[model samples]
Target: MPSSQTRPTPAPLLKPGETVVLFDGVCKLCNGWARFLIRHDHQRRVRLAAVQSPEGQALLAWAGLPVDQFDTMAVIRDRQYWERSDAFFEVIGQLSARWQPLRLLRIVPRRLRDWAYDRIALNRYRLFGKYDTCLLPNPDHEQRFLKITMPFVAKSEN
Candidate 1:
């Protein structure tokens, strides 16, 4: 098995043919973002997972991200990991055209963009408060969450 520290392109982590959003489960702001996604994503183009969950841990480890400190959110699709602001733009750009204009934020320098994102993200819990537990999908949106049907195995380092 490859060391969790190295990026592992394990497509099996995905429940097949879906874009996944990896987020901070307890962060009210992140939960708000996830709900926003659920509401506007009429196409149902993405599934959400909290970074503290097993599924999120597997995806983050596969992407060589820190599983302990989820200071950033990411997107996984087509066996690729899109992190930080890149992940933000990737999902919004795929949403309805009204949200498409948000993608223009991409033209800003990545350093500046990520810096702003980091400030808000790092302070999310303080600014918005946190949930005692992760968000649970409502009965109607339960299917929009990702669940591990089978155990995820990491690759050994060569």
Candidate 2:
């Protein structure tokens, strides 16, 4: 339950066995993906972070990713980093039936698969639009979200 506000930003470096997903929090499609994972991730196997958040930036830097490129999803798994299609596939592999079918696309050549992924990512905002701000987690699932003060967590009456 570490809050981004209180923790000093660590110099960017990858951590072993930790799976951190960095995403564009304000993107409607991205938020929907996170929510879907939250509901289906029965074991709570992944950690979430908004690409715009401090912790997200730290992670990106540590993983040696470009700060300006937050358009694609990034997954840091087993101390190794994956971006674009690889990251998306890795995520789906960990989720339930809701996303499991995406794993089948892995059989396609990496370049082609990534090309499709990039097209969708590039047009995500145009197709799905975006939130004025990051989506807040549902109270019951708040514990699954990475806490960042700037976006302001929505209070859950529960």
> Cα RMSDs of all predictions?
7.6, 8.8
- RMSD of candidate 1 to the truth, in angstroms, is 7.6
What is candidate 2's lDDT per residue for 1-158, written digit by digit as tens?
Answer: 11121123333432445567889989999998888778778877787888888778877777777776777888765546678888877777677677777678778887887899889999999999989987777788777755544666899998
* Local error of candidate 2 at residue 34 (angstroms): 0.4
Best by lDDT: 1
Residue 52 of candidate 2: its Cα lDDT?
Answer: 83
Clashing pairs in 2: 12-62, 13-62
* Local accuracy by lDDT, each model: 0.83, 0.74
TM values, all candidates: 0.86, 0.77
lDDT of 1 at 96: 92
